[model samples]
Target: MGSAVRIARETTEQVLAEWGVGPQEPCTGPVLLILSELVANSVRHAAVLSPKVTVIFAGGPDAFAFGVHDRHPYRPALYSPAVAGSGRGLATVMELTLELGGSAVVRGDADEGGKSIWVTLPLRRSGAPGAR
Candidate 1:
């Protein structure tokens, strides 16, 4: 989990930087933690051994779309916060997504035999995009 989190954090930092999101704006701590959690979940439950995770950042002024991919066709459903450890992943993701002033989705794909979980976060009042 720690390794996956580090890779994601590094990748996000690099990708967002390339997309014009500086060190402070798109690379916030809570956002990093949320992504870390998502990556960890994929590593544990995507059901594909040696599965790889990919990160992509794309958006305009209104929002920043963050995506993570893994080698499983199974998609994750939203669970309530009261459901305990196994259920908190998606809930925390949704909370972070909403808190960032944007939306999120998890989709299954048989075409590639994998799943992609994504979230779009908006920069706050920075005139940049959606959240802070």
Candidate 2:
């Protein structure tokens, strides 16, 4: 678990750097933390027969989207964040996404053998929480 967290944090920082997220921007911490949590979820409970977790980090001129595809196809549910530890990972993701002016979603292919959880973070400040 500690190793996974380290890998996830390092990978996330590298990804954010690649995405051109500036040091002046507040998205760095939130994005990295969100990425870590999502990756942690996969490592902890995705029923991955293999330990490989595929992470995708993409950014355009306006938005950035981070995705992690795991082995299991069971989509996580949106539960109350106040439920003490029921679904804290996804909840933390939601909070971080909100802070980053983004959104997080979990989708799974029951027909297939995998699931992907994604968060799209916008680049511009106008796309942020109170932006019009």
Candidate 3:
């Protein structure tokens, strides 16, 4: 699980760097942290039902998005009482994303089962209004 988190972070960093988003960029830190929390949630909650998890990342000039997917059939709400013991990871993910002017959604695979939680955030310049 730790290795999974590490790999997710490293891969996301590399991809962002390749996209010309530097480590010190305003969106980079929150993006990485959100990815980490999503990946960790999948590992801790869905790993038993889904042995493998996938991380998907996409970005462009305006905004960047990523999703964490698992084969488990359960699709968790962004803020639900059912997710009590899972810690505050998802809550933190939501808070940080919204603070950065972003959005999140959970999509379930109708045919195959499982779900993917995706988050998208605008790429704001350091001095831009609302940049964090």
Q: What C-alpha root-mean-square deviation, in Å, does candidate 1 show against the real structure? A: 3.0
**Largest lDDT belongs to which candidate?**
3
**Per-prediction TM-score, please?**
0.77, 0.76, 0.90
lDDT of 3: 0.87
| TM-score for predicted model 3 compared with the true structure | 0.90
Residue range 1-132, candidate 2, lDDT tens digits: 667778877877776667676545666666777878878878888645637788877788677787888878667764454533666777777766776668777777576678788889876533466433
Per-prediction tally of clashes:
7, 0, 0
lDDT tens per residue, model 3, 30-99: 8989999999989999989998989998888879999999999888778666455567888888778888
Q: Write the per-residue lDDT of candidate 1 for residues 1-132, one digit (tens) a residue.
A: 678779889987776666666666643555677788888888888735536777767777555677788877766665444524556777777776776666778776668678777777765434444334
Q: Which of 2 and 3 is the better model by lDDT? A: 3
Decide which is better by TM-score, 2 or 3: 3
Q: Order the candidates by TM-score, highest first.
A: 3, 1, 2
